[model samples]
Target: MSTTEQAVLFSCAQETQVGILSLPAEQAQVGVVIAVGGPQYRAGSHRQFVLLARRLATAGYAVLRFDYRGMGDSSGSARDFLDASPDIAAAINTLHEHAPEIRSTVIWGLCDAASAALLYLQDTKDTRVTGLCLLNPWVRSETSLARTQVKHYYIQRVMQRTFWTKLLSGQVAWGALKGLARNIRLSKAASPSRGAGDLPFQQRMANAWTDFDGRILLLLSGNDYTAKEFLEYADADTAWSKALKQARLERHDLANADHTFSNRLAQTTVENLTLDWLATTSNAIK
Candidate 1:
């Protein structure tokens, strides 16, 4: 299908946010909003978001790739993913307005932006959002990071001949061993109590996941430590483990892909997976 692109401006927390809207030739009842991760913009790493939006548009899905609050062309002080709920909500509302036929929407996010998508659901139970496409979700806590490093890095290193060669030649720095020890200690330490005004972001994400009635597409990159951390965190946490086992969740692991699905083949796979999952989501609405 042919598609047209348009620049859009929306309001969020009294700030002007910028977005590029990709509209299919035909009217689409299901739209997709790309919630960009930080230290980046709508174009994404290696133009991933740009290509994704176009691919979805060609597949007859309207896509809106936008910069929330302080990122990209949006106006505001820099805010992390933890504070992106309002921005995501505003983008959804704007997309609905622009494409009035849209009855349901999916939020597509990578890295920390995936966490922000869950946080948005937690903060506002917006019925408009019917699906989520999360790529390598961020769950980087001290313990999670330590566990991921120990499991994916140190364990694999010990199994490699190169590691033994380095050790035998005294090429392995003492700091490397000390760092491993520190991570081990941190990994074994008990988590601190929360006496909060607000729940931790990870807990909030788990809450959203447990309560969400919609479908979820979880894409994990095997070569990314962030992806490993998310897996470790989910496996270790009761809330996350239970939530992940839900029937609504669909997961895929791209074994050779990096965090951003940077290569052409991996990017194409991501886009195809999204298109397929979106087809199911749109069908569910009908």
Candidate 2:
């Protein structure tokens, strides 16, 4: 299928949001709205979003990659993904308006953006979102971060023979030991029960995830700490796990990929996986 890209500016709660809508010659009933995370804009880290939008559009699905309030060319004070529901909603609305052929939308996001997408869909109870494609979702907390560092970073390094070799050779960084000690303390004091569902932002996502009766795809980057942290939390608690059980859910891991899937091969893998998932899990597609 052929696709064309259009720049879209839409209003959301008095702020002007900017987005690029990639429309196929014949659009699928289900479109994808990508949420940008952190300081990254609509182009994504290494233009991942731009390339992804074009690829998905080429596969016959409409895709919208946008910048929230303050980021990119959008106007307003700078805001993080935690407070981005309005932006997400606005993007979805744009898709529906510009592409009337689109009957449902999927929120595709990575890192904190994934967290924001879940929070938005749950808090707004927006009926238009029929699916979620979450990649390495951000489920960080002081405790979780501490515990992850202690377990995955510190413990693993300590057990390594090279660590002992460096220690004996006086090449070890003592400052790291101090940091490890602090993280260990936090880990011990931190409880797995004190995860996302307990905080307002994650709470919204948790509520929505628990009650969301839609299709979901959980993508994991095996080499990322953030991805490991999410798994640790899920293994310790039932909040996200139980909800996932009730939904039409699938999970995949790119064992050699980084957080942003920066490598071209990794990016292409994600592109293909997403298109395949959208095709099979589409609620609006017969």
TM-score of each: 0.96, 0.92
Q: List candidate 1 stretches off by more than 4 Å.
A: 191-197
Q: Write the per-residue lDDT of candidate 1 for residues 5-90, one digit (tens) a residue.
A: 99999998789999999999999989999998868888999999999999899999889999977878999988899888888888
Give me the candidate number with maximum TM-score: 1
TM-score of candidate 1 versus the correct structure, residues matched by position: 0.96
Clashing pairs in 2: none
The parts of candidate 2 lying over 4 Å away from their true place are: 168-170, 190-200
Task: List, residue by residue over 1-286, the lDDT tens digit for candidate 2.
Answer: 7888989999988999999999999857878999999998999999999999999888888899999998999999999877899899889989999988877789999999999988897679898888899999998877778889988889999999999899778899777788999998887663434444555455457778888877888899989999998887666556766765664788899999999999998999999899888988663356
